[model samples]
Target: MNLSHPHSSGTIVRCRRLLEPALREVVSGLHPWGARMVAFAMGWAGLDGREQDADGGKGLRPAITMLSAEAVGGTAEDALPAAVAVELVHAFSLAHDDIIDRDELRRHRATLWKAYGVGPALLTGDALLALAVSRLAARPEAMPYLSAALIELVQGQTADMAFENRPWSGPDVVTIEEYAEMAAGKTGGLLGAAAATGVALGGAPELADRMWTMGRDLGVAFQIVDDVLGIWGDPRLTGKPVHNDLRRDKKTLPVLAALASGGPAARELAAVLATGAADEESVRRAAHLVEEAGGREKARALADRYLDSALGVLDECLPEATELRDVCHSLVDRVS
Candidate 1:
């Protein structure tokens, strides 16, 4: 888990090239205003309903789909529909997540709720979710996996919101294992389904089942890395402010791990968060306390453990899965 591993832009660039057109086509099929709003959420259109040249997301879920297909000896073209569907699912989740989290920005731009109002943003998210299912309806095999993933995603989101309010209004502190499970559902479920559907549609059912485990592990690892970045990542690279998670008092992995430690630093962290209103200086101190309490190392080790497990699954299933391995490694090492 060398955090210093060089970041590479190549894999994401290739993924966008393969996926962008298909994504655009799906959004274009929506009702005109709905299409504009969804496109705005996707960084494709401005608040004024005009197309923009801004960069969108990393397209990581679809990349996982295509790479998983390729790893099982299928062409990316064979998995294009599944890739597009999963990418749409990911984008839909983000649109709603921003509203739920009250986040004001994404990809260095204003969040949809901030720019266009919550009603339009919520409707836009719903539109994308419907489009995701409709896009894959022609291939009924993809539906079961997609449906199950959506259920898990919603459960995860519900748990996340519940965790936030439990302290002031309810009982019990969030545990580390519970946080990991939430991450698994919110993040891993979709990636697993993406891999499963891609390989199954590409003519390999057995391989698809095994790849689901690999993808799930990769997705959990990816979320842990995201948690790290939320605390320590540079704004220039992450498009987020420093100590963003700490500022919000979000129950991310490192924070939970630190709280679970029960050390002096953890006690300090608990005191700061008990107020539920952290100022900038308190957020910075919380970051140091989380690290000094060994939360950072614990989170990194867990991420590495999951990543290694994913690699092992890939090895057993597809020994020649170099491309998939590279993509996973790049995600593990990403600066943003």
Candidate 2:
């Protein structure tokens, strides 16, 4: 979901100027005809599709690419191929994620599944994944790290499906530790891989995993911000209605905390979330009840904790990673 005011437009512009040319050049150089075919399949046929999915992202992966290169004394230009690959993989995930979550709108328009239909969306996602691998493979220096990143990225997706389908058969109340574990697989997996791949591209295998973990921690914080926006964000900014998360009966940090608070609001919030029995008024009441029960405060605090953890990991993992470290700080400290 788009968070209403949190996107850093300035940073995004910087990323675009840094990434777009490199992405295009690498794609063209790799397997000319094949790359265009894959892009067409993924609905990147023109500016519209590209902007809808790829253009509007936070550029976290691109940031990792650039920063990792700098961390190891490589120019950002040298890491363009890897950066393009990271963006492709990230785009693939978003396509499938929208379908799985049944979110009709993306970047304020119908998602690929809605616009072109599910079959196309699925095929497109697969194509993008293949394209990402091809980009990495085409660049010899980035291959080793790229392979490992793919493994973790795919495994994380598996873990995400497992979480939604079975949920560990535990209490409905999502624990902080449990949420962190899930976030690692869902968000951390790709970010970690992207960061580590950058490190490897810079010829520093010794620091790859450390870079990955740093990215993972940053991703966890990012996910927490997402959960917060899912529940309380302005509809105008994020392009999702209030209570969308509650409507889906999905587990989020705030909802889980409200459930565990043991109060009337917590009790009612639990009932409504469990059965989806509420009308509009009822949903409003449940939200109010959750705040009365301290869920709001708890969610904010949890987000802060993860942010701290991510910064701590960055400090330790990349002792000399100024560029990477700066990007990490910027992402976790955002308030838009």
Candidate 3:
């Protein structure tokens, strides 16, 4: 289940080999300054505009696009546009997300907004989105899904931001159902677009809807795992300060679930959270209480269920897509 499973790694390598040239070609069209900023955001270069080895991201979204295409018996080239589009959108989201969250780090480096000014970083995110739209401008079969995903992504982000003001325990508190809906929109939408566009461009437009649903389900699972990591994952591996999400008062799944447990640990965790886990001691205590209240275990179980649902769609729709299935499974299984 490790993300480094040979099959998954090989698939990623093959997909990236086909993806890089196309991505660069599109990015090259940007103004020099814009391109340089993008290079930094993509881990292709440093803030000084010199190329450097940095962790951009896992390129999971694009990998899914290409694999989904191949799964449907189409060539990787058929999915290239969609792959590039999804990756660009992924970068765009990150640039904006860092600003929204006021996060200073990403991929073990300064975030786009941190390295550059917020205004420039925001514009860079907009530029990325523009490029993403341009990639599909000529393809009506796939454009709508990407557009829909953009809308959903915005809605989900708004909901997440709104959750910050709600009390930790009350009728107005964010629920698991609400969290899943937000996750589906915020994280799932673009993933859904990737799969939908992949299948649509790959020659099986009829299967796009099912694949979109599958990706959304997968997204929920992926988001839940991310919530776990945001609280408990190693800063070295995650490339950000641990417990940053909690300090920001983000309504992550683990915290929400822990509070719902109604146990002594959950109560203590809730009290600590209500005080605003701004200090290191409180954040650490809250993390431990979340785990002690069974939040971590419950989150994992829920993630498994959603992943299973996604896999089931793949099973019924594209039974021959073993590589795609493995890659999707590895996403939720990733440790960092």
Candidate RMSDs in order: 2.6, 4.1, 1.2
The true-versus-predicted C-alpha distance at residue 121 of model 3, in Å, is 0.6
> On residues 6-97, what C-alpha lDDT tens digit does candidate 2 reach at each position?
43445446765888666666556535444543444333553232422432556767777877777787777667777878888887787788
Give the alpha carbon lDDT tens digit for every residue of 231-291 in model 3. Answer: 8888878887888888989999988999999999998988999999898899889999999
**Ten contiguous residues with the weakest lDDT in model 3:** 1-10
Q: Estimate each model's TM-score.
A: 0.93, 0.82, 0.98
Best TM-score goes to which candidate?
A: 3
> CA lDDT of each candidate?
0.80, 0.67, 0.91
Task: Tell me how far the alpha carbon of residue 235 in candidate 2 is from the true structure, in angstroms, after superposition.
Answer: 2.3
Which digits, one per residue and each the tens of the lDDT, describe model 1 over residues 205-285?
777667777777877898999999888877777775667666665788888888778888988888877776467777778
lDDT of 2 at 336: 33
Q: Candidate 1 has which clashing residue pairs, if any?
A: none
TM-score, candidate number 1: 0.93
